[model samples]
Target: MHQTPSRARSASHARPLPWRGLALAVGAAAALILAGQARAQDSGEVTKSHGYNFFGELKYPADYAHFDYVNPDAPKGGEIALAAQGTFDSLNPYSRKGRAAVLSSTIYESLMDGNAPADEYGSMYCVLCESLEYDEGKTYVIFHMRDDVTFSDGTPLTAHDVVFTHNLFLEQGLPSYAIAVKKRITNAEALDDYTVRFDFADDISRRSLIDQVGSTPVFSQKWFEETGARLDEPRLETSPGSGPYTIEDFEVNRRIVYARNPDYWGKDLPVNIGRHNFDRIRVEYFADETAAFEAFKAGEYTFREEGNSRLWATSYDFPAAQRGYVVKEELPDGAPPSNSGFVFNLGREALKDKRVREALALAYNFEWTNESLQYGLFDQRNSFIQGTPLEATGAPSAEEKAFMETLPVEVPDEVMNGEVRMAHTSDSARLNDRRNLRTAMKLLDEAGWTVGADGKRRNANGELLTIEIPVNSSGAAVLESVIETFVQNMQLMGVDAKMEKVDPSQYTNRERDRDYDILFDAYRVFLGVGTGLRQVFGSAEAEFSLFNPAGLASPLVDAIIDKALETSTQADQDTSLRVLDRALRNEFFIVPAWYKANHWVAYWDMYSHPEEIAPYDLGYLDYWWYDAEKAEQLRAAGALR
Candidate 1:
């Protein structure tokens, strides 16, 4: 479905957008026209913020509503040196979209901060609203807005704003987060200027918890109305917000400057209690990844948490890494990376045969991909709950067994059903090849495929077995190499496979329409675990056009996701989710690909942090910073010159 034009799903979050997103195109144009020679704050070299210097993650606002996740607890904040690659429009939090939408919120903020898996990782700490209580038998969740909270424009932040933004997003049907928000809220009413109450219709066990605490970010009711633009407009500027940083200067297709909110209302509130400690946070934009990376090396920006490993190995050797200031340390005990894999679009007719699908999964050499192209940089996620607290890792605790029994999810029936767990047989390629070939041969034989004279499998029409995989143009050259290996592996198994290198525009259109036979691309889901997995593998979700590869959703699997979403307890949800995942695994719904184990990144050693260089909880950008003195020193050392 063609989604709305909002710059982001929720102005507060940057759920990954389509590669080469239109929002990115706009942000780039905005960044270029806006650049000018840096001014020394119209004063001499500046230093220190009162008696405290801040560091760690900082904000780089794209607009009033969209902000990048640059942590706040870094070192002494100063003129922020950051870059962007797209337009910084659509600052309103409720209707923002894409990367710039992320930039906007880091400059601004909301009522609560929710970073991850809500079952435990998500906790709603009040930002503008300090105390929240569920009254009227938990039928209505009441929020007490902090009296001191005010928008950057000096208007009081009130309950009306929260209610209005909630309703606004609901009306817009934005992607990335619309369905997530729609599930919980029946009604959001502005009870009064300071107190707002939410009324719900379902027996939502965590109703107050998820809504008031989980993912919903409140916006300024007055500021939005005053701005007089639709929330998703690309021309969005003059965004009214009361964040730790206020928009000091903004150019449509250029850079944005945010001065520290001298009157940041929630500076002492619970969510803002010990964060947002920078004198300024800025976000600039560029056109391409190459431009942005080059600029970072030129000392124009400070950090990049990335996918480009070649550069990290080669680039950071800039003189900065030699000094103590430009420290580079590989973090220890970081959370496991979210699994990145190709989700089979089971909507097509030919892929309906689960046997053919399983055959494809056995063909991918994940070990080879990880070792050669990635230098063993990523981890292989064997389970659905990658990085989640209760993933089926190591072994189950007594607490886990007790937790599993109460929920409606399934425990793998490997022992009972005589099913081979993919995990067990996939430890090595030779073993996988033998096991996978056996499995593939059995499935294909059952599907009416006959063996030819040469011992190659053939369909009913006697054509050599073949499956077409589409590779898009943007990264087609690398994908061509990856697919070439895959084709060779398939050929080794007596299957014919060919790569269709097509324009990304054409490929993406076909993908959205579910028009390809076999495809290679990552279905990158954030928060690797949560309820409603049916959205990805459910039969009913199938009609909603969700990905149910092999079209193999039985009644049991569909019921599990439904129960998990409706259940009151996290344990209950986990049990159901585990069952759902087990069902998916048994069906072989996806050919698993590689995952990132580490966010291999580098800054010119000039980057500084308030906290020591550390990895963030989950994959959120909490362990990044910017340095002005070191940045200037790098500049003085002729890095930029």
Candidate 2:
């Protein structure tokens, strides 16, 4: 799932007076002039704040020392080696041309930093800017850039770079992003050497506009111009970034090393304290999960987030683990689980009908697969926003029904009067659930597909009911077993279903081109709703949006998302989201899969973290530190080289 970064901070009603010294009269005159200029910018009173949030007030004060989650005095040194499963040919993650290396974009920095705590939804604190200025109506926003900020190449990061980067993305970034941004922002201009302003469009909701602009990854204008690098193209050369890490070395399909910049401009910033602690981050690539796991056991990589249930349950008893050289831990995760599933390609003619889609979804036996193959480690996912307050549970309330009635599209009776729809259940002992297969067959027959003499279903046009599932090679070890069972069950229902295993590069291209009947991916669910929903579920970009694989374009879904965005209070937003969940469940576009509530992680025992991990993020790469003493102890014991 392409998770949308939430953008926000509480609006300040007024700007604070600047401190004065011996030149008090001069300072007073300057302050009055600034106030007069602010009044001329908008009809409502102008306000200046250090951050912005859409949902509620900011948690940290303007002059706060640092986030409570971080260890401000944590030491920073040593390397943390990790693993990647696929090959990467390009260093640019923003473009769609080639597979981008992991953590490629970490070299760049946004204008503001998003709040990491799970409780502070939609809050953002300033990073590049000293403060943000806007009016009560939020018609426009101005960022007061800090003069001390500089790119890795030591060039001053001025307002001109910010304006240039914004325009660069508008012209060359992904189509979905370009489309959404153009509609929300009217203009981005450099008002001065260290001040930038963005004017908002009057048509759309203004709540996410500040965040939309603030979260923009600012690139060095001078570097881009000097190197003549296009944001849309793939290349190995990287543009100078103002962030802490810089690419040190990389070999295609093998390894990429990122070194922390000793002269990082924001190293001493309050928001950055005790963060970006790794002096070096090394990523080793493997052909598949088996190889990756083997490498982890051999100490080729120091850390691994175990995603394979079988490995977590049965394969962690290697010599290093038994000897206490490795640590296998499950950390608490409070964020909503990812809505992963088998997504139907609605653009395909054979799968477009609602009945056909529903029939395909019923073929997967989640209970049997979870117990028989996955070691019963996951919970079957039912809602797009599963395990959250927004998840629709019982029958719709009177208010929810009334809200649905106002939508432009028709609401199904199941969503209006019945209980919330759930995933089909099956007997855990069987590979093929006869009950579900019978129902699937009946639904397909109703949808005009009949079983032929050859025992394969065919439509009126004599077209075979085919479902092709393309699996990425890197994930084949883990996903193929589950898909194999699903295909058998689907085949038993008279549908010609098969799995196509391909390498990472081919899988990336094929998914982008929508070249399969069914693909496994996730539907991103956000705590705070925003304009980003348009890219995921809106009808406008459904045809070509890379973020939306299902090609889901429904007037009802679009209407509910819009309603959620326009809501004023958190309560109203939750109601609208519940309505959305109900509507999406009724659509039956995705075959619900499974998820776990905690993070399964394994690492060498030389690392340490805060006593309490942040609720939202594991922060392994952010807050976790390398212990020199522990490393020496491990090496002396012949556990690490």
Candidate 3:
């Protein structure tokens, strides 16, 4: 089973913004400039190189030995156990049918690696490909595969495999991938045994398109041909992949272990030099986070990344911690805070009115939640791209205002005046101030939801204003407490708000079907606001897909996204993004939630990591390695029972 490489395409769009101010200066009339460059490709001045970066210059040149952040001499020969919640039935991660094993991606490698240092602004280095070719316009790209690249089973990888992977995704994978790829890729053809060419559509951003295609995992064409298996099927036993590790052992729905491939083809690739250090990586599954945490404390799992703030603050006082057997640390989470919140389904007639949405937002008491519930460990997230330059700050820039004016209604004056804030009660008041609820009541009344004798808000026709927030069963405990607090606040304003916990599968289905009143999910901000935007807030997605869970179908939003995608300069991109952020905020599509400033990680102190972690990611797979001597020392110190 040759697997597709893990790409940033899945998580990049969820978070949109350039971190290092690397938005390239494509010059005046950027599209025309790119077109001119495309025409110049006939002159043969275009450079074919080993790698390319998204931003300015590549940090590492063609002859670079290894990444600067890795420890080249680090030795790895021990196992590292990690905890995973819920169960997995299939090893095929590409399929939408069942949950895939946690280590499925380790067995696959992509053509180019986008796991560059976080500050690199989404650059990628060649992995399986020996070198790549592209013109200045990036209208097309050619990947020259390494001659020695082969699957774990010794089957050679070729251009046909890459072509087959792309075609396979188009034919049988998720509709989102198919639709997106079809829109951007004009043609993907195998030019030779080890050479493939990809012609891109001119309408999309060339840089984003190239990054996406380059990061796609190349699969073995021969294996699929021999097995006659569809790419979308949930297969328990997958074909061998061309990566660092192979599935060593597994138990269905219990655990899985991956062993490093001693004869791995690209073990010495510069991109992989200090990465994938674990000799064996084992993952154990539990029913929920509580069980997973218990397993971590019991030493069943070697590491845990704590997501529950309560557990982080209150737990860890056990014998392991008292005996200095466990280590707890807060690592900086350098990425911009996600715009997480309760999203309204605009498809519901009652939620369509802007005033209604605003009224519901006012009912949320974030300050109280942070102080009393989260122990002040979280900060409120205001912008979709909060903490980034693209976030709409004190006011829209002059360029942003100019772009906003093109729409029928630019943002409200309050948005232009200063930083947009959600309704908050002073912490000292402990949610004592009823002013926010009064304001909510006023807004609801103005929106035709009047309080009746029954103490429920109702419209003229006597339909009560009801909001049902359905949460996933796995997160029921954590979210239920938050929802209870919010529902109480909404009830004070005579709104019939309630919370319901459902199975993860049911919740996913309902979200996809748009069957709930409001949803709790975060939209990933796009790094390079390209075709990915269409899947998120685009009008077409609003109609056909679940990406736009809010059912937000606005011509204004569509235009703004298009403008952002077209802008090539940092200034232009920033302005268009600010305008888009302002517009989204003005709609109150998402009732803002809170985000923690750091990652809460706890381990048994038997692993070694690079001195500096990637600003955006923990880099567990890329840099961290098992420490055998440290493990033995811990055992001697009674850290391990």
Which candidate leads in TM-score?
2
Taking all chains together, the TM-score of candidate 2 against the true structure is 0.93
Q: Candidate 3, TM-score vs. the true structure?
A: 0.90
Q: Residues 1-641, candidate 3, lDDT per residue (tens digit)?
A: 00122211222111223232234232343322121111224565565666665433454567778877788877867887887656677888777666677767558777887455453554567888988878777789898888899899998988999899989889987776677778778899999988889998885665467667787777888888999987777788888899989999999878988899999998888888888798887888777778877888889978777777888889989888877778898888767676578999999999999888887887777888777877778888887777766777666677777776765545467655656554344443465347777777899999999999989999999999999998877663566788888788788889898988887667756876788998887775544455666677777757655456788887777878776766766567668777777777766788888888787888888888877766776766557888888899988987675
Cα misplacement distance, residue 427 of candidate 2 (Å) = 0.8
TM-scores for the candidates:
0.71, 0.93, 0.90
How much is the lDDT of residue 381 in candidate 1?
Answer: 65
CA-RMSD of model 1: 12.2
Residue-wise C-alpha lDDT for candidate 1, range 1-641, written one tens digit per residue: 01112323221113322211000011222343212112123344232110100110112211212222234444545554455543444454443232243356555555555432111222224456655555333455566777887777787777877778777666663443356446655777777888877765566533223233223555566655777665554445645676776667777656766677777776654334224555765555665556776677565765555554445555567555655334455434244344445556565554667777776677666666655655556666666555554344434445444544554555454512333244423434332356666676677778766678786768778777666777765442334665777766666566766778665446545665566667764432322223334344556435443233334455656655555545444455455444444555566556766666654545455554434333233122222344567667766766654
Model 3, global lDDT:
0.73
CA RMSD of each candidate after superposition = 12.2, 7.7, 4.7
Name the candidate, 1 or 2, with the larger TM-score value. Answer: 2
Candidate closer to the true structure by lDDT (higher is better), 1 or 3 = 3
Q: What's the best-to-worst order under TM-score?
A: 2, 3, 1
Better candidate number, 2 or 3, judged by TM-score: 2
Cα deviation of 288 in candidate 2 (Å)?
A: 0.6
